[model samples]
Target: MKEKILNEAERLFWKYGVRTITMDDIARRLAISKKTIYQYFTDKEDIVYQVVNYHIEHEMIECTRLIDQSMNPLEEMLMISDLMRRNADMVNPSLLMDVQRYYPKAWDAFLQHKEGRIITDIKANLQRGVDQGLYRTDIDLETMARLRVELIQLGFDDRAFPNNKDVMTTQDQLLHLFLRGILSEQGFTVYNTLKNKEYNLTAYENK
Candidate 1:
């Protein structure tokens, strides 16, 4: 029951911003009484915290899985980019803002995950790319990694992009730009091939 509530609440929160979702909304969605939700979580804040933690854990595991399965550092990044694109498509533009403004605990947990594990993973990937001669050795790995990490959260800032499509477009453009800056000649060749194939497939599907 607890897991069910968490899953449903996460869905609602992602689709609609967190501040707009009341406990009653969750209960109603689950076809259960408000009291039942209270039994599992003390308040909306608790649920938000739990949901954020759950999301972070799963994201970390997914990133690890991608890393393990990918043939190279660049492939791993593209896979993660696909993951981020899918997540952004589902998420409300104001969701992160709502959590940052209204939910301190949940926001802090997200910050910790972003600053700690995410940055670490990015640094590792950058180093691997450098070692494989895929990325420019002249770049500062730490600074580049941190920049990429912040760029991920920047996509959620509604004030900047305003529209969801604009946000996605900016993110995609920024990612391509970043890759272009970091990729060595050999890496660029591989990236160009993959990107061309992706573009062709997307065009075909849209037709």
Candidate 2:
């Protein structure tokens, strides 16, 4: 029952803005009484908080697994980035839009927490890349890493509006560009090969 309510709430909260959704709406959508929902959650705010927390926890676990340091840093970054882009609908950016649009406090908290975590992750991976000779030296790895991380987040975020289509900078392209900037000659070739590799959905292994 709790899972059902949360699942429905996650959908509703994403489809509609958080402030625009109410307890009654969740109950109605689930075909359950408000009283039943209240048993699991005290109020709409409580549910919203739970939904956000749950999403964050699930994403963090997936992210950690995908960003393994034992693998090549660039490869790790690419695979994790693919996971983020391909799974955006399951991610919280859709719900986060509502938070950003309405709940300023929640938005601020979300940014402070999640963005900080990502920065730390990127910075660490970048430092590892330098140590492993996968990335170039002489550049400020911290700033460049932060920029790449922000670009990835913005790419997935529908909030950053741009007018260009083909030449338009997407998160993937942004990532490639960032990688190109930091790559050694050898790394650059490897990255190009990765980009040109055809994606295969039939067997699901080419990405």
Candidate 3:
């Protein structure tokens, strides 16, 4: 029951901003009583925190799985980028702003995930790519990795891309530009081919 509540809550939260979702709304969406939700979570804040934690943990697991299965560092990045793009498509642009403004603790958790594990993972990936000759050796791995990490968060800024039609394209172009900057000659060829390939986003549908 708890898992069901969280799943439904997460689905709604992703599609709608968190601040606007009340306990009654969640209960209505799940066709359950508010008491049932209260039995598992103390309040909306509790639900948000748990939901964010679950979301981050699931993403980390997926990241690890993709890295493990990838043939090379570049492939892992491409997969992750597609995953991010698909997810961004589903999320409400105001979701992050709402969380940051209304849910301090949940926001802190997200910050920790971004600054800690996400940065570490990106740096490691960059180093691996460099070693594999897929990335430019002349680049400063740490700095470039951090820059990439920072750029990813910009997708959440609705103001940055005020024209809704261009949001996804702009975000994708940011990633592609980064890839072009880092890829070696052979890596560029591989990237061009992979970019031209039809990426199946069905796996991330309604993420």
Candidate 4:
């Protein structure tokens, strides 16, 4: 029952920003009584914190799996970017802003994920890419890895690039730019080959 509530709340919260999604909304969406929800959660903030923690834990597992199974660094990045692009559609534009503004505890969970596990993951990916010659060796690994981490937030910046949910998404463009900036000449060739075959960038308007 707890898992069910968290799952439904996650879906609702993703579709509707956290600030607007009330306990009643979650209970109504799940067709359960408010009493049932209260049994599992002390308040809306408690639910939000648990939900955010659940999401981060699940994402970390998937990210590790993706990185481990990738054919190369470029393929790993492309896979991650594709996943993000798909997820961006389900995410409400105000979600991050709402979390930061209203839910301090949940926001701290997000920050922990961003600054800790996420940074470690990207740094490992960059090091692996550099060793494999899929990324430029001369680049400062730490600085570039941190930059990539920070750039991840840009996808949620609605004011900068509003969610179009179209063929050419802002997230997609940002991914292309970030990948191209880090690739070696050899890496670029590999990127082009796979990108043409897999993504078919020509299908998008920005191409």
Candidate 5:
């Protein structure tokens, strides 16, 4: 029952956004009384906390799984980017922002989770990459990792995906702009070569 409420809440929040959703809305969708909804959740914040926890826990677990299995740090970094891109499309980017904009506690929880787990995982992968000569030694891993997460978030902003997205931000263009500033010559060559390879986001239904 708890899980059902969370799932229904997430689906509603995803399409309509957290701010626009009410406990009545959740209860109606769940076919439960508003009083029944309150029995499990004190308010929308409680529901949102559950939702954020759902996302953060999965995100952290996914980050760990990718990092643990990756043979190299660069691969780890790319996977993180890929995860953000795919997850944004799958989940509610707008709801993600609303959490930050309206729910300070949830936002703090997310930041703490990122700092304590996700960013640390990224830093470890970055250190490994530097050791393997895949990334520049001069670059600070912590800062770079934070930047990557922020950039990924920025990439999902509706403004970034303009209505007139006649010219969208290609994966190649994004990689070229960011990777060029950080990789060594050998790194640049590998990145450029990979960048030249075909990317398949056209399946994103960008039109």
Candidate 6:
């Protein structure tokens, strides 16, 4: 019952931002009473905190799997991008903002994940690319990794991109720019080939 509540709450929170979702909404969706929910969770804040922790754990696992299965660092990034694109619609733009503003514990959990695991994985990816002669050796791994982490969250900043449509496009453009800056000639050749193939496939499907 606790897991069921968490799952439903996660779905609702992802579709509609956290602030708008009340315990009644969750209970109604689950066809359970509010008192039943209260038996498992103390409050909405506790639910949100648990949900955020659950999400981060699953996300890290998926990311690790992607990294392991990818052919190279660039492919790893593209895989991660595809994952984010697929999930973009399910995630409300205001979700992060709501958490940041209203749920301090949840927000801090997210921040810790971002600064710790996410940054570590990004740094590892950069190092792998450099060692493979795909990325420029002169780049500072720490700085670039931190920058990428920031870029991941930048799309949700309403002040910067108000009512932004097409987050995938924004992410793709940012990735292209980031890759161009770090990729070597050999890396660019591989990147361009993959991009051209993607473009051709997109056109073909559109036709």
Q: How far is candidate 3 from the true structure (C-alpha RMSD, Å)?
A: 1.8
lDDT of 4 by residue, 38-105 (tens): 99999999999999998787766666667777788788888777665656567777787788889999
Least accurate stretch of 10 residues (summed lDDT) in model 5?
Answer: 198-207
Q: Write the per-residue lDDT of candidate 1 for residues 83-188, one digit (tens) a residue.
A: 7777767777778888999999999999998888888889999999999999999999999999997776777676766765666777887788888999999899
Cα lDDT of candidate 5 equals 0.68
Candidate 2 vs candidate 6: the TM-score winner is 6
The root-mean-square deviation over C-alpha atoms between each candidate and the true structure, in angstroms, is 4.3, 4.6, 1.8, 5.1, 4.7, 4.7
Q: Which pairs of residues clash in candidate 3, taking residues 3 or more apart in a chain or in different chains?
A: none
> In model 6, which runs have C-alpha deviations exceeding 4 angstroms?
196-207
Off by over 4 Å in 3: 201-207
Q: Which is the leading candidate under TM-score?
A: 3
How many residue pairs clash (N, CA or C atoms closer than 3 angstroms) in each of the candidate models, in the order given? 0, 0, 0, 0, 0, 0
lDDT by residue (tens digit), candidate 5, 1-207: 887788788778876878989998888888889988877888888889878888677566666777776556655566556655554454555676788889888888888887787777767766876777767889988798787666656655667665424222443255446667777776765665454433233211121
Residue 95 lDDT in model 2? 57
* Global fold similarity of model 6 (TM-score): 0.90
Q: Candidate 4: where are CA atoms >4 Å away? A: 162-168, 197-207
Kindly list the per-residue Cα lDDT of model 6 for residues 1-207, writing each as its tens digit: 998898889889988889889999999999999999999889989999999998777677767777787788988877777666666657777888889989999999999988878899889999999999999999999999998877767767776777568666776677778888889888887787665333111111111
lDDT of 2: 0.68
lDDT of 4 at 81: 72
- Compose the digit string of candidate 2's lDDT tens values, residues 14-63: 65657678898988988889999989987776787777766667667776
lDDT of 1: 0.83
Displacement of the residue 2 alpha carbon in candidate 4, Å? 0.8
